[model samples]
Target: MAEAFTIRYIQPLWFIWVIIAVYIVFYAVFNHTEINVGAYWFAVITIAYILISAFVNPRDEMYASIIGMPLGILWAMYERKIDSYFEIGFLRKEIVAIVAFVILFIGRLTLSVVGFDNQLFQSVLRNIITIAFIVPLIELLKKVKIQKRFLIWLGTISYEIYIIHPFILYFFEKETTEGKQVGNLEIVLWTIGLTLLLSSVLQIVQDNLVRKVKL
Candidate 1:
């Protein structure tokens, strides 16, 4: 069980760590610098990495996500300024973003249904669509009033949910491989429930450990 869990989780763990480390270093260097060369350098590096990965290991989708790191940094740095501009009342930036997101999402689905199998193009398109969806969605969410304790709890555990849900999915898929026919809805529900439970437990354990260390 330990070996199986390790095998299933190691790559994702490593990938997340690498992303975090890269983002930290990138942010540190550019955050205080007068001349922001981070984006330029990141673009160059990302292009090179993509080209090499495409030629050498075309099967790897990791490079596609890595390319978005610099963009994330850029967005973070300018997000407040962008948000202020979008808040101008008449521009309706959120509505525009939502429309674009829906159009792109539908277009992607239509293309897929029609047998569009260009991985690189699809990956790029998906990234763009995600950014379009998320930016405005986040802006809109900022105005939402959360009165439910469960939703508040879910928000607190969201990161852990993201990290642990893949393992849950993998475990269920493995069970299916061993002859258990788990339906899609069952898998989704199980993944969510298990993720929330595990993350909450882990968070409590971490808090206790921190208190013990401080003591």
Candidate 2:
């Protein structure tokens, strides 16, 4: 929020100082309140940014591009409250998820073929894909008795898997491809195995660092 607003006041040194002074006053005033002072600051600042961007800023295009991100953040924060709202249709949820993904894949291919990059069109399509796939998948998982925490743990290391996967694949390409012929299925299994192993190691290292910080 501050970053979005900073460009306007960057050149005026006094204005920047005034913002700092206001923050100091805000903290001092809120220090006696019941809620965490930081949460108040965050909510105030985020709302300020959204209002200014939507009403004050003349660039509707920029606002259009950025509004989805904050809405997504808000949705995630209140996801548990709205889990039941995603129940969509008569079709089985897993089948619906698969069909949504296949349609999304075809849409992407069509985009590539036609080279479509209209911002508004892509933004609408992105939200449609999220609604078509993720919302249904959540409902389906509930119906199938899948543990939600399983997804939570995987989400934790998803970034690590992405980071370490390329190195793992490179090693497999170097070692396995030269020594012997391997099927695509074998290569995929090997990649997943090594990626999981390395991601777990990375998580362990982070846990240790966090523990040390607390100590």
Candidate 3:
């Protein structure tokens, strides 16, 4: 498996040119608000230069492109060692859950007392937190797993995870939102549990679809 991944490091120069051209086209199209004819032409010229450099210095190009990622990860580890126990000290999952419950309960009481009605603010904050913390943590956790097969399978089914989540949200969203708002423990648990359960099942279906296409 390692050897298979290593082989991709020597992809043909033509593919690099193809990548550069496609990038120029897509970037120009996406940035039409700022990209004028001169800017587009300059971008094309710059992309050509990058491709030329890649072809002329294949090893350097390959290392510059891929090597920095792992090095950056190692540098992060060097700065802050992973002390999971210390980080999560005295707080088991259940304790953490209880803490979250207490915080939400207090927040609800405070909001009622203050007569605050900022549903939009709450929704925006939830989205910001999910994108900033949850999504990145999920991706980092995925990388830490030592199982190659697990990662491969996850990669295969990630599209389904992304696509099916909206449908699941649409179906259970009202009940889930109401439960959370009312601080209903049972509904909160059931919503999370069902979402995960259904998402996993959908992943399997997506994997089958991917296999059919690849085969």
Report the backbone clash tally of model 3: 0
What is the lDDT of every predicted structure here? 0.69, 0.58, 0.45
Tell me the spans in candidate 3 whose CA falls farther than 4 Å from its real position: 1-115, 135-143, 155-159, 165-215
Give one digit per residue, the lDDT tens place, for model 2 in 85-159.
Answer: 445553664575778777996896689579896544565566567656666666666677546886777877985
Order the candidate numbers by TM-score, best to worst: 1, 2, 3
Which structure is stronger by TM-score: 1 or 3? 1
Ten consecutive residues with minimal summed lDDT in candidate 2? 9-18
Candidate 2 residue pairs that clash: none
lDDT of 3 by residue, 104-199 (tens): 556655775697745433433333333334323443454475578867666665644554444444445555555645345654566556655666
Off-target runs (Cα >4 Å) in candidate 2 are 1-72, 87-112, 115-131, 147-159, 174-190, 204-215
Predicted candidate 1 versus true structure: per-residue lDDT over 177-202, tens digit per residue: 89988999998888878988998986
